[model samples]
Target: MHDHEEHDEQDSGGGAAAPARAKLFLEGRYRKLCRDLPQTVFYCPECKGHPRRRRGCARCEGFGKLTRDSVQELVGWVAGKAFGTRKHKFHGAGREDVDVRMLGEGRPFVLELLGPRTFQVDLAALEAEINRRNEGRLEVRGLHWTERQRVVVLKETPHAKEYEARVAVELAPGDPRAAQALAAARALVGTRHTIIQHTPERVAHRRADKDRERWIEFLSVELEPEVEPEVAPAPALDAAPELDAAPALDAAPALDPAAATAAANGADAAPARTYWRVRLRTQHGTYVKEVLSGDSGKTRPCLAEWIGAPCRCVELDVTAILDEHGGAEEVVEPAPADDAPFGTGI
Candidate 1:
């Protein structure tokens, strides 16, 4: 993604001489894309995803792979075509499960164009094209040129991320226990909690089996209804509360967290299913899913433990990478590495 050595001195644009190396930067805005796609090319383990396998692989219907879609392939294709080369590397700050959606400003990445023959193109136009082709799927933002050194820095620099998670909950409607969960979640907002995580069960087969410490910096918590409530009709002008209303009722009803959400959304009844929208800030490489499940007790002080009930994150969206100026980590000096485009894909 970024080479340590400065390549900017060379002509990366109009100069006649071929540029030593050129890289493109893009922040991928994934709204709904990648839900069913992998971050990189997924080769079938059984047949190596080789299309020409002597015995047609029934698993992949002889196509040799499970899915043809991936964030890397989609973004890489446009850049490769524009740059006139297919050789590149994907360098991401971190990765998310394919089931997760990337949102907000999108994830930053560098695509290293290896041995580019066409040194330069209109970046703005290229960005527009990428978005147009991937409409409703993914969008590229902050597209520009950068040094290869950034790739290594991006790799080494720890990324703190924010996510919006929809979790399935088991608490009964109007359960007094909800307050305990609410209080526990709120207590984490402005503090830090160190957690010990074993290699998550899902990735244990490929990742090293070991214990790792990660931190959870809580951001926010909210109760979400399964179905969004309709906005109530505007109140009659005369029915509006007086500017100076009486404060006479001493036995006012206790606050119902769901009531607040319901009043705002116009619903008078609870949904059939209960869900909570919890926003979390976590260190790079932390197992976010495990933070909720405790991975069968491997992760301590997990969300499950905090709320004293079983919960699972059913939907997730990345809202931010809080490592740059906007977040906790200081800006890292771009370090060097290969010349291929760094695609910081999950």
Candidate 2:
């Protein structure tokens, strides 16, 4: 995961000459095909992308990369071609994992055009071309010109994000434990929590290993309604039920509708597992994936802990990039009190 606001400072296409600059908000999704690509170009680590070494390198097949293209490449190719510039820097408000799709208002980004031959080209046209060239792979909106200062503000300012996660949760149907889990999940909504998070295992190599305080507020959580399956194939919508298919209520009363439906779909009589849709708002720098999974117990009081089940985020989408980085309250774990009896002396 790029952590959203990641960037690198690099030289312009024209070397010492000043580069043309612009700020545009990239509100786009990494569609199915491009999900594996990172937000930036990933050079071959084995060969360092060196031409001579890359030629003999089987890892990247001498192409200098393990894979083809990226979000930065796709946008840069089109914009750089229009500007006659080969180099540019990509700045994003925050970066999502390559597999996660960005939705809703999208993430903010600033493109440093870097020594364009001409600065008078129509931005709307360039935006269209970028979308058209990468139709299924990538898309963007709000292409316009702005100053270099916006880039600084984008990196320096912190912003929270809203995410929608489709999580697969498990619970034994018809067990008392299922009701307990449901109650636990419902109790979590409309509450604010401050938790201690150790660096997640996935990014531990790059991130500092220390306890960090992060906050999240659950806006809403909804469970998909369970459906009772029918023994026979369900009739098409708007079609009348066949009288011969089911016997009269008085004659076949032994099997009630509820019992009949349950018996028909008997896989222990319930679906047992279903998706739970979660909508939450988190502070900047908080890893949403780790928050849901508890990251092998590294994150305390997490969604997994609250639900009392193993939770896996199957689908994730950003709902918004909030402009505000709200004030954070410190996390203080209270010390346990002495267990002396009320009437007894210490």
Candidate 3:
């Protein structure tokens, strides 16, 4: 019977029929240095990565991608070389938009090497080699052997994230109403808010048209006047000759109810060319941009509503990602400098 079992194993290509394929699981963090870099390669929307010609493709213009490289490609290239395999899979805990910067300790990720020639490679050496190759463009750290199940945990786990956004307010400088608006913005701190957000118009093309509720653990805002020439003083209402005829009217026209409500809520007196800084903590998957502009009333109780003025998110950065144990990932650098702000020069 033992001889028969050995023959069966060899005949089935299990033992002597072929070499066993190896699998190596890795756990680590990836930091994206460039703002334009994405977490993964994006193929041409038209060809989906199969370019018909070498000279050029109409959709991708022969470049093959909207972007040249990504965190996934960088890490995969190094891992595949180390394992002597060209096929591998990259799994990240979460991803940031291409325009947004990923700072702090970096995002957790796992790389799965399939059909590797060997599993005897050193993870620490691999980490150093990968970092050395990518340099300032990308960095990987804390690489160690991990189990396949970790990918599921990282993908399904929900954790809060902290973000910093440079916001531009429609309020103007030197206006008395600016102080009131600033005060309202500051009041958002320490308040727990539940918000319902509709898909933002910018991303509605790919995202489902749906409403989702999210929680804001904390919010803080600060405003400063733009550095520009002082505005010319406005002529007094009494000095205007056209106003002299208005006193002759029997009575002033009735105020529109909508306008009256806006005034009462302090939303009518918006300032122009003013900017602010916001630090916010929110549950995973919350649309921070929509939270800023209200997405045309798609996001209820938004910052624009709180400040009683229209606002826009000029730049955004992920400052931290909290782990299940309430520990924060490594924060390599502080939040982006506020002096230049977003929409300003690099």
Candidate 4:
């Protein structure tokens, strides 16, 4: 009985060993295949057709072995090998007009260095290496280890942006009408939706032509003032109490309940001075630019059409963009109770 039990134990041990041997054999085969496969041959531009030499040719300066696509591929390979990672994703804070250059602090960005085995790697050194390798055409900073999930927020956040743009306006010569129109635009109030018909000409290759609605809450314009000639000094101050007590012509009275109610409810009654330096807070996705230009009359009651003068935005900047899913309250006033019918003239 003892001999039979020992033999059973040995058979079970052999069964486990067989699978281990097989796994090792397969791994060895894979490594052998990788080694036996020929190293990819890159043409030497300097040598005119020959393979690259050990020291490399003087003419191409070893660049004969490099191509843009090949360099990218090598970067992926080295990053994977050194970090033992799968892949990486790069996220930009905001997209530039391809034609526009990002000058300051090079717009905030996040890079998802995925599946890294060496999470403890020195990030500053890695960033420096990458910047050196790219020769500063693209730069990276704020490099810190991050998780995959943060990439989602980086992509979705509606970050408020500031833009410095130079706009050109086409108006009829000697048209003071243009300035008046721009002023009227600033004083305009209330939320307005404008539908934009995106043209294929500008974004045809990358995006589909689609109609999108954007809301506008505020619009304003400023023009360089014409310098005035020197004028004589004004008269001396008046000491009369009557003059001091007299309300200043520019001063307006304190809040009138009726006027406040009207303004809150969006009545036709608006403050005087049609021209204003309009500053307003509005909803997200508002096409302030299209609202100013009218986009071929897609935006109705536009500043240009309203003032009977061509209008364009000189500078546009976003002060804030509220969270899309924010919650707001609507006030409900209590209704007055109806009087009961008198039973006997009580």
Q: Candidate 2 vs candidate 4: which has greater TM-score?
A: 2
TM for every model, in the order presented, reads 0.71, 0.70, 0.73, 0.41
RMSD of every prediction: 13.7, 16.4, 14.5, 25.8
Q: Tell me the deviation in Å of residue 164 in model 1.
A: 1.2
Question: Mind giving the per-residue lDDT tens digits that candidate 1 earns over 8-38?
Answer: 4535566555435544443333333557767
Would you list the clashing residue pairs of candidate 2? Answer: 4-94, 4-95, 5-94
* Error at 52, model 2, angstroms: 3.5
Worst 10 residues of 1 by lDDT: 331-340
lDDT of 1 at 275: 77
- Put down candidate 2 lDDT per residue, 249-279, tens digits, no spaces: 7885465778778777783554466567889
> Which of 1 and 3 is ahead in lDDT?
3
The per-prediction tally of clashing pairs is 21, 3, 9, 1
State the weakest 10-residue window (summed lDDT) of model 3.
1-10
| Model 1 TM-score relative to the real fold | 0.71
List the candidate 4 regions with Cα displacement exceeding 4 Å. 1-87, 101-108, 114-121, 124-141, 157-164, 172-174, 189-201, 224-289, 298-303, 311-322, 325-346
The candidate with the higher lDDT, 1 or 4, is: 1
Model 4 local distance difference test score = 0.41
Q: Of the candidates numbered 3 and 4, which has the greater lDDT value?
A: 3
